[model samples]
Target: MKSIVTADGYHVPVLLRESVDGMNITPESVCIDVTFGGGGHSREILSRLGNNGHLYGFDQDMDAIDNLPEDAKFTFVRSNFRYLKNFMRYYDEDSADAILADLGVSSHHFDDSNRGFSFRFEESLLDMRMNSKHSKTAAKILNEYQEERLADVLYLYGEIKQSRRIAASIVNRRKTKSFKTVSDLLEVLEPFTGKAKEKKILAQAFQALRIEVNEEMEALKEMLTQALDILKPKGRLVVITYHSLEDRLVKNFFKTGNFEGKADKDFYGNLNTPFKLVNNKVIIPSEEELVINPRSRSAKLRIAEKL
Candidate 1:
């Protein structure tokens, strides 16, 4: 399957066919693509929909506006997916047959040096907000957060074992000169970025700051909870996660209807859940897909149906 590309090549959808196929679209089924970065998945969903079927594409990034498909069956919601329920209510949509979310950062973001999503752009300011209007930025978090809080962000979000030491270093260094640019933070992280794992450590540190700035985990939780409410019985929930943090939440939610991954048992020992797992095992990008879109190496697809 060839990767789908938008006019500006905003993103090449990862697990393109597999993710959309998991939706099990019907000609008249209404669907929602909550992460409409490049409209790759939404476009595919629209293609499968009949005239009566409607698809709502949600995105907070201003860049996504240019990629919107001009079709009567599609509506673009210019808001974060965390407010999925609120927007659905505002639009008078009671339920949807399918919902898809691709939780990876778009290629456009990483490729755009000004976004500061990639560590390679040392000259750029650390402004990693997906929605530029948001008040919080990576620079603010690095400069403002206390040592303990900063450590927690890196430890939990980035899974950096030396987070406390790193945070302390950052706090000590910022006393004289506050962090402003990617290079500022990079200088503080110098000790940790050894030759063998230089790129890996830097990537983790940047990811931590970006996640904190965007409140990604919280938003994902809110969106998933609302998805349960807005999906019709037997409706499908398909998600493509790029990291273990997001994948764990989606996996737990699908299997047990909670983030803790605990299963509730009835008298017959039946595992009670709002959703039935559509894929027992997670789906990863095929070798061919990885060759086509190398950034999709970490992509994992999971699907579930509302019971």
Candidate 2:
């Protein structure tokens, strides 16, 4: 039982014990932590590995570099997990024993006032690129996207009911004053904010913009598809997802070997799938953990083994 303390509260790994345990790591197993935000989960994995074991940590954010661990067995890949297969091939590794992906945004991103991940900071610029190098920003989406496209993002990604109305309002508002900061967007959203669910609604709106700016869904699909090719027989795939959209994708892929989640029947009527579900029921943070880390309340962990 190893305890990992993040550097300056960069991120507190959610479901740390269950996620790692699900990996079923051996003393010489090779693993990859795709969402290596704070190195909390990666450090724990390293502690359980022997000298022969190796762990690769992937992160697109420049801030994650500061949290890299000092260990010979660990390699830090400063790239997005969408490029997992490419990097693995580049390193001459044919397959991995286990792969872990914690898809929640790090606390450090929301806490940083300048990153525009949180609407709590009124004056913050609407720049939600996980990798700062990305050209698209939340402000750009709000200012330039067509009303119909904007509505689709809000409705499909954010699950907002008033997406069309909101999109119309944004286009109308941007014509007079282009959205540059969080406050500017907040002003346009003022009408949509309900009395009780204001915070949740605002959070959803921000999440949609962030997803669009980062192309999160496309990346997740690509990474998951590539993961199947990279995992060895009986290799473990442990994922911790925060939102329903991503959780659904992971659940579907783990159950049916495809994003559609359709179960095909064989001659004996048995479902044919490439992976076996490790936990039929999704793992979630315990009540004790919830009290300690409120941000982890929405996290759900799912594990699968390659067949």
Which lDDT tens digits does candidate 2 get at residues 1-307?
0112345857677899999999999989999999988888999999999999999999999988988999999999999899999999999889999999998577788888999998999999999998999889999999899999999999999999999999999999988899999999999898999789899899889989988999999899999989899999999999988899989999999999889989998999999999999999998899988777877888899999999
lDDT of 1 by residue, 210-276 (tens): 8999999999999999999999999999998888898899999999999999999999999999998
- Give the TM-score (vs. native) of candidate 2: 0.97
**TM-scores for candidates 1 onward, in order:** 0.97, 0.97
Worst 10 residues of 1 by lDDT: 1-10
Deviation from native of the Cα of residue 176 in model 1, angstroms:
0.5
What local distance difference test score does each model get?
0.91, 0.91
How much lDDT does candidate 1 score?
Answer: 0.91
Clash-forming residue pairs, model 1: none
